[model samples]
Target: MEKFTLELLFHIIGIGAASGLIYKDNSLFVIGDNSGFLYEYHIDSQDLKRHPLIENPSENILKKEKPDFEALTHFQDSLYIFGSGSTPKRNAMVEFDLAQKKKTDTKNLTNLYEVMQNFSSIKPEDFNIEGVIFEGENWYFFNRGNGISNKNTLFKLHAKKLDQEFSMTSIDYKLPKIKGVRTSFTDAVLVDNKIYFLATAEDTQSTYHDGEVLGSIIGRIDIETMKIDFTKKISDSHKFEGLTVYKNDNKTIELLLCEDKDTEILETTIYKLSLNLK
Candidate 1:
């Protein structure tokens, strides 16, 4: 593994609790955990635009009533936003049309989530999903181990088939610990058959509440081997929950990350991380 460096890119005000990020065509698309708006930040112009995803007068929803959208991924012309599935109310998937700039479809993943919980033997209180990866016909959901179960697992299923009879493949991963605190999956992206993920170590063991963050790490898993290739601590202060590849080449890989400060502040900081591959 090569040494990684971090740099401050910019900040997006009023987009607090930024949880999911995707960058394409020089525009950064972001979704917050507590907000009902999709934000687009243009890199060249430095302009920010917000598109409402729900009917809200204040543009932000109450914390207790929010959908808790924690993961974002796009397929073809639509961007899929998924709830954390920590509670009964957070079991929805919102599909936003990228071209139309509006919501196109919605799905309730309650049955699927319940089945995963049962198969994984994870208690209801410990079943928080924080990340998702959509590649070809497979969909991989990353379940955080922040709760009592402490089982960082990856669930894979056929994306085109959602019937109840379809079986899901469950794979467990033991993330490295930071300062004696176990790290849990936050977000992931698949590139060239390699899966890169972000994991954070928080102080608390409950998935419903926030805790003092110990640190965050970046790791990789090769699809062919299905094993952890490497893991390295990225930050000891910022609790990053969203990750996207900003740029990649033969020598280095640049990633863009969004931080969850666990506060009521109306701003989010975007960081640029560069990893030397040589």
Candidate 2:
């Protein structure tokens, strides 16, 4: 692996760290899996602001409980945030109209998450998802597999309306595993129409939530050829959860990698990763 400077962007003080990241409107937004609040960071001013998801006022899709927001992305003029559905909760997506900063749509993705959770071979905890990317008219949902029976399943949803009524297709997408190591997809991003993954392996015994951090990697999936490559690996202690492209010069691009400790540290981390992929 080439040496890249891991520049700290923002250490989330108090509350929990971020599970997903999105860069839009000259700002960076991070989501908490335990909390439904979106932490916004201004690039130029370095201002950190917290905003709560406005409850969908309509009783038809009104949810009293805060969904565990896991994935964040931007499409057109709106920002979409998704819940993990780790425990079969009302898996939904909250869409914010960036032009108005108002919750404009509420999508119930329970049918998608519930089917994966209730699969005969996978357990509810093993069916967790953290990686999601919106490209073209399809939304890619990656389940964080524990290397047990699951192989980082990927669900492609053809979204016509950003909500509940979409067709979904699934496939078992596998990442490269170190010797006897079971890895999972933490997050993903699409650059130049190609998909790159933030793959990390933890030393968990498959029956736990958090585990000893082992290895981290930045991988790529050539959608046309349908090939998954583990191009670079990071042997650090950081449990990277989110990834976004920051700078794309002629030669190298800066990858913004965010970390979630999953502990009571009251702080989050973002590292600027530089990769010279020719």
Candidate 3:
């Protein structure tokens, strides 16, 4: 098996400040860290469009601060958007209605947030969340913690029948320590029978605030066992916050990643990663 290769494909001003990516309706949707709209692009064309805010005040409790949505995924034709829950923004999820072209249900996830919060080792103000994937009829949520926050947890919850109620069980996850900056999982996708994760580290004291862009890489874990398998370093000092994994031509593994450098008005970058699974 050969290693995967990543290449910088495109750069856009103010558009690629992405925190999450999702593929639906034959297009790719990228969500920014602080924005209320979703950036939609056709798969093989340059046509890009902006979708309305997934969270509307009428359907949602008016939040004082803009909700920093981080992770996005879909299941059974329904699209889901989740907030980072690392800040004063309350934990929340919005379900999109395709027929109505708007958000249908916006639910508060206080219980699920409290569960993950109590499992943290850092101060209550420092906790953060960045990823989620649904596989095997279970929802997996990944939390990214730094040296200051000092905690990282993977949670699994079954949502077959429950609407807003979440009973998350923490899964065992371990990463070899990295020098200089703290590392944690940012985003993930399930490919084949394995779940791949994009782990990143930035020079920050707490996970709640921005830090110097330091490192980014990819790794995978066994779905059946739910344990770490292998990790490969793709960048030592670049920050990639969004990931989309799929197979093209029935033989090649392709990844779309977006970076957020915490810059003021600088264009964010999107990279294309290709590898052979062997």
Candidate 4:
């Protein structure tokens, strides 16, 4: 197995620490944070630009006691943001068009709040969306169930019909139970017919305020067999959050892993891992 190497470090303050990344092209990457901020950065130049897609400029939106679980993805030339918030403001999936010159705001595509209002049987607090990955006509979402449980659940959203309600279901993969460990699957990407995920495993032996113990691993989930193979683990202090496959010269495939953490305080670094699928 090949190890990941740090390529660059970026300092972005008050960004609420990035949680997800989406590579639009060879140059541009869209990053999302817990603060509802979406930033566009250049890979080649290493230049950073910030855009607040869901800021409450008027201070009208209800404030929460804790940070929300935010994630982003790009599909059909538009950026999609997903997160969970307070009541009447529960979890949501939104879309933004980046092609426009003006800063684009997020539009509610899937409103868990509305669903909760209509269906009293379903609770809004139960939804905690972490990340979203689009595969063909299906969009897979990773939801971290209330922090109390170690279960990292996956939900399927049909991309073809936006008007249709999103159906929540459990993924077949069984997560390993490690004592004193709080594991949550965050983001995922598809490469060579395999699904690679980024997850967080917090050591519960330490206090919740003691800071998160983060690590990353590369795994392959065979769609046909519904089996997962966690073959390689990334050894680095920087938490791996997002990943995208890019083609270098001679058509060689390079995997760019986005390190989503505060640079000034945390060991923020992006790693480039070369894949040799045999």
Candidate 5:
């Protein structure tokens, strides 16, 4: 793995905290951590549309009252959005139908999240789930090491069911530090057998509070071995939290990333990251 190039694509107006991203059919689906709407940005036309994920008003949702959607993934024909589960108020899973362009169902993941907390022995304050991806009959949940414990972990859950009988295995990782702050997982995308993930170095010991951004890192984990192949620093100014693959070839991979400035600004920028795969 080698250094990657990044380009500013365009700005997504009115979305302050773009935490999750997914690209499909020439459009980008964005989820804001402090918003009640799911946004669709057309790449070719430069048009943006907002679909309400819940009954509340889209952008007016308060920060403390928002669902804090931190991860997004497309499976089958629907999009699954998950909360960070850092707090009791952030334990919701929303399923949006792609064809219908509406939220079909929302699941309260309190039980499932509690099970994870108990199994990993992570305190409620340290259990911040920042990313999730699925392959075959397994779903991988990423726990950010931004809290007091600073434990970055990957929880693999067998997809038999989301009940007490389901099996789970965890792997802990120690990410590189940036500007004296250790980086932690923020988002991930699975390409073939390799999982590409984003980690950001924020100067905060509490999960509920915002902090100074040190930088962001991109890394790859080999699924077969469940180990990291490489980690690279992509940016030293922006705290990118969302990532999705736009295109990939034999020598290069094109990815789109979204960032949370940790401010009240009502706009977010989408960046293009090109990785050299040779």
Candidate 6:
């Protein structure tokens, strides 16, 4: 149990954040935003420098009217961007090549348009994809779960083969009901083989009407047992939207929490948390 200290802040509104420490000895991170822009940031001099990655070409080309960058993850030297709205022709995970600096292709795993046309329980508009994390051979997607009900849902998508069509299945997990908690699950990370997620919760009935005040907490998910232990709570104004684990010199683990200041018009901040992994 430890508190996070803010390291650096960048005023960028990103829907989701993804980072990877690869063999190049360079730390890479990608931030996807509502404006259909993906900005790549490199860690240098203890600051984040925005490097242009990719952006949606035109609104007319997209299926839905508004294409939001909801989820992001890195796999096989490529970054995957997922969302509900995308170009009508390709409305799934858009793969971006890190070395080429361009979008290679798109994969429509859910067939959102077709799913909405036929299904009743799910709809294209109801899909609010947020953050993604790779665990084992499967990639878990965290959905904001329909802005109406705000039900937290995790979708497991198999991505063992890049060219293979991914099959998605839902997993069960209960969102914490804390007083003044407004937002649902935002981001997840694996630490010591355990999954920990960060979410924002605020009072919907508050008179202040200042949007949702950000709060954070950590929960561990047992993969084998299919159980979530949310006993640890983190209360901070920084709204955590992404997390990454790093090893220190002494072989200790440090969790890097990324904050999404989308609504507040604040700078994006990253916090480092020293954890006691026992």
Best by TM-score: 5
Model 5 sits at a Cα RMSD from the real structure of 1.4
lDDT per residue for candidate 1 within 1-278, as digits (tens), equals 76899999998876788999999899999988888888888888889888876666244467778888899987777788899999988898888898998888778999899999999888899999999987658888999999987989999887653543565788899898988999999999987888999999998899888998999999998977788999999988779999999999958999999999877687989999999878
lDDT of 3 at 278: 67
User: What TM-score do all the candidates reach, one by one?
Assistant: 0.96, 0.85, 0.86, 0.73, 0.96, 0.71
Model 5 error, position 15 (Å): 1.6
lDDT of 4 at 132: 73
**How does model 1 fare in lDDT?**
0.87
Give stretches of model 5 more than 4 Å off.
160-165
- Sorted by lDDT (best first), the order is 5, 1, 3, 2, 6, 4
Q: Tens digits of per-residue lDDT for model 4 on 1-278?
A: 35444455344333334567666664545454434445666766666665655555211122342234356666676776666432334345556677762245544544544443233332344445556777657676665433444435665556554556666444634454323454455577766566666665554332122245555556556655546765455543455666666543423446666665533232234557665553
Which model, 3 or 4, shows the larger lDDT? 3
lDDT of every model, 2 decimals: 0.87, 0.70, 0.70, 0.52, 0.89, 0.53
List model 6 lDDT by residue over 217-266, tens digit each: 66667655647854355765655666666554334456666665544232
188-228 in candidate 5: lDDT tens per residue?
A: 99999999999999999977898999999999999999999
Clashing pairs in 2: 12-268
User: lDDT winner among the candidates?
Assistant: 5
Per-residue lDDT of candidate 3, residues 204-237 (tens digit): 7776666776677788789888878887778877
Worst 10 residues of 2 by lDDT: 55-64
Clashes of 6: 8
